[model samples]
Target: IHVNISAEIIKCPQFVRALTIAIVIVCSKPNHSYEDFFDHVHVKLLTCYIRSEPLPEPEIQAREVQCLYGIQIMSAALEHPGGMVLRLFHKLYQDSVISKESFELWKKEDEFKAGFDEDLETKTMAVVVLISFFLSLA
Candidate 1:
């Protein structure tokens, strides 16, 4: 019988590189919808990625990579053609997962605001990536 590996992968330690890869792979599958990214399972994962304590050298690196990968997944979801990028953006925005301060900066700062107002793809990625990096640092 086939099994859903994503659920199992979610249970893996946050420092496991495979966890990020598995999550992205599974969520990108045709059978899965963008909604899966906001599910409780992933919400918890995001919280862990943001709030978990730093680990030792190699593991810390792995954790950072995973956190970055998680952000990359969200960015990819937003950039995918024929996808609900706006819906995903709204979900992350409303849920406060995208960093309120950064989102505000995107709205407030002229340089950042212009890129965001123009709906530039790279700007979306940049904001989320930076916020995720900050989260990892915290």
Candidate 2:
């Protein structure tokens, strides 16, 4: 989990590589159940720092790939304890991390503003996925 958080929050390429390698390793272990692995491995998180300069194409592709991986694992992570799933969803939405149908629901809810503002991170791994793709081709 710390690794996931660090990869998302910290804009370092090294951390992204480490997190990607870690994710691939976790997914490769057939013995581990999705939920159990998620709980233990902590497959969660993202935060986008608005930047003036664009990232290199390779790095952008890498980020997009990471986000894709996060999207694949997100649903299962939500099934676990704590509000990780919802938190991730909100983070993703707030940061425009991913395009989700339910974002309309968030906009309709009165509590969304307060909740979104208070939370520092949005789990919009999907948004990252989308952003990465755009950046890669830029």
Candidate 3:
């Protein structure tokens, strides 16, 4: 689980994306249970994201990790729906792995407009997850 990137370098945008991609890689592993995935996410997320200083403006870093993670992790998340996926989403925000600004930007942007515009199901699922995560906040 030594993701190779240093704490200082983890502040970089590319490294953040790479970290997220690592999460996706673990998620896509075949035959894994949600519990197993949960363990992996907890470890990697805490190690790579929480321990490092969050990327902030004026710091010059990529900020799309949340949106990218939402889209890429959709399939794996959909498997557990309100259980694992929703909890992961909550942890992402609560732990500040996803910033409030990122969620706001995610809300404003048509994330699926590029190629997933025609995918009503995917769009719907993304919305559901977003709403669910928000509602849990209230």
Candidate 4:
């Protein structure tokens, strides 16, 4: 979830710090259940973003923020139980944050393969690893 903070945003140190704090809180591994942590983080993020002054294009900024949130959710899914993860994925898929077709391909890589293949596994694992690393940092 690499966010490209525009130059306009970068100039505002307070906003940047607030946004950074929000991101950190949202991505952090909580001492409590992930569900509770996620709920708290979600509410905090929405409140912070909503009350802030509008960006040049609020819709686009909102979409970028939503996409980042989706990635954070996906990271949580990977670290938790598979059932929990799949449920999150399903919800995001329905919301169109995650493409259903891409997920289906991820689900069917082995079955769809014409022959023995390492590439699919490698790619999938890489994504998992990268997300996990970021989540850890958060």
Q: Which candidate has the highest lDDT of all? A: 3
In model 3, the clashing pairs are none
lDDT of each: 0.46, 0.38, 0.50, 0.41
Q: Which 10 consecutive residues of model 4 have the lowest summed lDDT?
A: 109-118
Alpha carbon lDDT of residue 78, candidate 4? 48
lDDT of 4 at 60: 32
Q: Quote model 4's TM-score.
A: 0.30
Q: Alpha carbon lDDT of residue 59, candidate 3?
A: 35
Candidate 2 residue-wise lDDT at 127: 36
lDDT, ranked from best to worst: 3, 1, 4, 2
Cα RMSD to the true fold for all candidates: 10.3, 14.9, 5.3, 11.8
Best by TM-score, which number?
Answer: 3
5-124 per-residue lDDT for model 4 (tens digits):
665654342343245345434555645343333344544453444334464544434433343333333444445333333334444344443343344334334421222233444345
lDDT (tens digit, per residue) of candidate 3 on 22-45 = 565557555655444535455556
Comparing 1 with 3 on lDDT, the higher-scoring candidate is 3
Q: What is the per-residue lDDT of model 2 for residues 1-138, given as tens digits with 9 covering 90 to 100?
A: 544465455564334334434544455443444333323223343223212138765554445434433433433344332333344444444455434433332222332121123221233433333453334323
Residue 83 in model 2: lDDT: 36
